[model samples]
Target: MPELRITTLIDAPLRTVAAALLDARLLARAVRGLGVRISGGPVLFAGATLDGSVGPVDGTLFVTRADTTGVSAELVGGPLPRFTLVTDLLHTGGGTMVVDSVEWSSPGGPFGRLADVLVGRGLALKVLEARAAAVSARSVELLSARVVVGAAIIRDGLLLAQQRSYPPEAAGKWELPGGRVEPGETDHAAVIRECSEELGVTVEPDDQIGPDIPLRADLVLRVFAAHLTEGEPEAVEHRAVRWLTAADLDTVDWLPADRVLLPALHPLLT
Candidate 1:
């Protein structure tokens, strides 16, 4: 087996590169011509197995390990010998360094070895570079430039907290069920939109609580005090919803930003 290593520089933030790499579907789209598909029937957790084809070569792309910062995959079977690809992302002074390494057997036996001696390494690496670069350099402007909102609904001396269902980092953590504030939309409007979209209810905002909290460089978190206008709160996008008294506040695993408002929330619950 022969291995080829290539490192490409990208002028984007590390977070942006990391976010792009973690999205398997986006990767499939970015390198669609390479015939890589995440449609591996069913995937387990943490990573995906991609089915792909290049030239006379076809194989299942196995994800051995994957995370925000790095990922490793192996291309196996088909007309080609088995090989693995390892990719890493790191922050550099200018921007980010994406290191891509591919190690694989070419064509197979005698005839295959002959082919490799001719142009196999070049051909194989050409395809690998195309695929890897697709993942390394897609624009991440949209991912970083986003803002979000949260709602704190207090009723009957209890505060409502919903468990997040996605973004494994915040999964199962208690938070207010609100989403991104739309363009030209007020925080109150966003609270209503999110409550209706996420919790299946209508709410009227009473006042703003705490202060604007930064979720990221470009994302902001805002909390609002509101009362249900109609319909009881239903867990739409959340894993579960619970109303807890002041005594239960300290015990609940509130999401980090939401936890900061616990003191302010205690007064409203009373």
Candidate 2:
């Protein structure tokens, strides 16, 4: 069997780098020079069948794995069952290191490597190098993606809003009560968690209430209609909490992102 190993260091966190590599849309954009494109499921587990030109050859790239730490794939349904590729992401003091290994068998004894070099030059080696560089360059752009959750609780025909206590930029602005979604938490789960921490109450999200408002270049805010399930709503993390009727909505100065929802949130309130 003939084999090839290549490694590169990327200046991004492991999760961020892994996300860029596993993302089908990003890969499609990055792998252009290799002529590889995701042809099947960017599935639940991020599985995909890839096909494209590898020099003069065309065939399917079979993925054996696509997980958090690493991924593996093999080129098949072609002349030589040309290659099997393994990739890993390791965390280190500096940043993430991407290690890629590929294996292939040759017909000739000692000449197999020479044969691979001569015959499979384009797609097997050159394209792979270009693909790796592409992935590295793409890392910075995706590092900023963030998701935020907010709760809009209504009770007795009034909508609950809270005054920000800290974070100078938002110190006095009124806004929906919620916070960042932690890893492995669903939106509703985040809503419930945020309510507990900020309001000292439990809330059940009934439905999503407004558009996904962009909080900044990379942060998004999603508001959910919730009902308090337990404990009294208190300003545990804020300056104050107020419930306002629909007609009084415009009276308070709201955080820009939360204020955008008022029109959509109007009909939902009593």
Candidate 3:
């Protein structure tokens, strides 16, 4: 089977750009009017589903793997059998570079090549563009939230922490200030609101920490930098609040889900 490749440059930060591509909900939203349905697992690399029409032809594509590095999808049990498409994402300076390749082996030799030339390239490119647009819009949406935001409040090279409110499930473990997403609210807004309601202090959502990192179970956390704007840090919803430098991060008890954000947050703070 021969491979066909296509590459394009996207004008956005790598991590931010990558988050957009990894989100299945964002993909579905971006391809809304295109007669397509897209869905995916919680984590980026888990898997995804794509179903819809390309021009007059209908097909379904299954993403076997997707992450910050790349996305791989196969056209299984579709109009075109044994066709596979893979998209790789790379960080380039302040933007993201996307490369997509398609490969297939059909019994109808020469005729297959001709079909690929006539239809495959165009269809593949359209899907890539749709994916990119979805990611871009989602990034902007996360950046525009006013309340309930993901936060990593660092002081003197250490991140701040709060003990979980709920017991057994998330009890006793320390975590970044944030909470469940509310209806009609952006992830960033949800984080900000969680901080305010839990800490009894106003926090300003500042910079983004990293890509939308997914937990082992099902939570997708969009981390951001937040600054304390009002009130002393008080234990309202949580058991306690403390500041931990990079060196102290390992010492404090952390929630299992929030562990994913540490890798990305550590380097920035320390």
Candidate 4:
């Protein structure tokens, strides 16, 4: 087995870089080779598969892991016998340092080993450099994006949900109670404040749940697990509030952003 590593610095927080790295389209473009246009993939979540081909050399990029820390993708059914790509992100001085590492094995024994030493290694380096460049450019655009924090307040196996009353399009659509993170406000503090203002209840926020959902190029939505600590909840800002069991999650029309979190939300209840 042979390994190649490349490093770069992106002027963005680890979260921002992590978000950018999850973009399947970005990964496709970054890994494109020799006029190849890679396509066909899901949202790049962990365990997702991206199928691509370069002149009949087919490969499936399987995402083994993805998180705030980094991503690991294994390439199977390609020119190489084994290929695993891992990206490690570390917080540095006001930015993040990214390291892209690829471990691979060439097929066909001696001749193949010689070919890899001569050509494959260079091609792999090019791919790694391209991926780093793409991520860096995308992360810069996300540096100032605002985050909207949603609280999934659960009690006795039921999740709290609220219906929108304003904005003609979203009226009656259900979503978690939340709003944008104020400038200089931490995500946890924003979660506490939004629940208090929208549900009229005090909440103790726990860890975040689900992948960060992008609402727009400049906005992202994050969900947090929380519980009531003081005051009963009242629908102070929405049309209605309901407690739903995991089985009842799909019964209501959820806002598009919140709907994407259903998979992650189910585990908290069950």
RMSD of each candidate relative to the true structure: 11.1, 14.6, 8.7, 5.4
Pairs that collide, model 1: none
**Mind giving the per-residue lDDT tens digits that candidate 2 earns over 1-270?**
666667889988775566556544444555564545545433212234676444444567776666556667777876555667677889999998998766776555656665587545655565557657776876666566677889889898889999998899789999999989888888899999999999999988977664454444355567889998899999998999998999878778877556656666778776
lDDT tens readout by residue for model 3, 1-270: 656676767776665556555655665666565545545444343334566444343566677755557667776665555677676888887578877676765547775666576445565556656766665666555443333246787666767798876877778889888776877887667766787787787777777765565342234566788877787777888888888877776666676435545556768675
TM-score against native, each model: 0.51, 0.51, 0.49, 0.68
What is the per-residue lDDT of model 4 for residues 47-67, given as tens digits with 9 covering 90 to 100? 567776533346887878776
Instruction: Output the TM-score of candidate 3.
Output: 0.49
Candidate 1 Cα RMSD (Å): 11.1
Candidate 2 stretches with Cα past 4 Å from truth are 34-47, 107-115, 118-123, 148-270
| lDDT against the true structure, each candidate | 0.68, 0.70, 0.64, 0.80
Model 2 pairs whose backbones collide: 2-104
Q: How far is candidate 4 from the true structure (C-alpha RMSD, Å)?
A: 5.4
- For model 3, the local distance difference test gives 0.64
**Residue 248 displacement in candidate 2 (angstroms):** 49
By descending lDDT, how would the candidates be arranged? Answer: 4, 2, 1, 3
* lDDT (tens digit, per residue) of candidate 1 on 150-202: 88888888888899888998888998878898998987889999999988899
